[model samples]
Target: MITKWEVLSLIWASGVAYTAPRILNRWSLITTCDPIELCQGCRDERRYVMQEGMTYEVMGAAGGPLQVLVEAFAWYLKPFLPALRRAAGRPPLPTCSKGSCLAHTSTRRRA
Candidate 1:
């Protein structure tokens, strides 16, 4: 029952209905290509101020006198601890190859 002009009009209307929203919703449709230039002055300065304050607090706590002294003492004693342990006749540290690997491999083979 449709005539030629009516069919062409219907096709044009359907095409517009399908593509209009997609064109409108595109990222470039609503936003500027030079976004950084537009937004450069809109950033919140409070966040930067708070971050600097927290950095100063953390640095003060980590480098306090007692912390510095403890770190220095540990560094000084690092080389002597192994020799002292041997002289005390404590058993040498356990080897992972002897204990962990043997147990896991034995269980896997049995299974």
Candidate 2:
């Protein structure tokens, strides 16, 4: 049989555990800037490092694995995102269905 205090404690603990990641991630984003704008060939690398660091810190504080596999997969893809974005010329977003949108989508979707 669980006491009221234990139930309350568990609720609070779960809330903190759930909310902690969002708080930490927001803080991490606030602390870091776009690497490309700050450093040459460094944005992707820096972003990855920051992401890894942030994940490590949050997981460490949470005292449990929090989306570790997902984060790790994301980290693996981090380095390629910028390149992927740039390889197609770093085109602007599809505000309208223009050539840029089609070109970007087709290129990426191609085998």
User: Model 2 clash pairs?
Assistant: none
- How well does candidate 2 match the true structure in TM-score terms? 0.31
What TM-score, computed on C-alpha atoms, does each candidate reach? 0.27, 0.31
lDDT of 2: 0.48
Q: What is the C-alpha lDDT profile of model 2 across 1-111, one tens digit per residue?
A: 999999977776666566556544533442354433333223443455466666678557553345433343343355587678788898532222323333223334542
- Top-lDDT structure, candidate number: 2
Candidate 1 Cα misplacement greater than 4 A, ranges: 27-34, 37-111
Clashing pairs in 1: none
Give the residue spans of candidate 2 off by over 4 A: 34-111
Cα RMSDs, all models = 31.9, 14.8
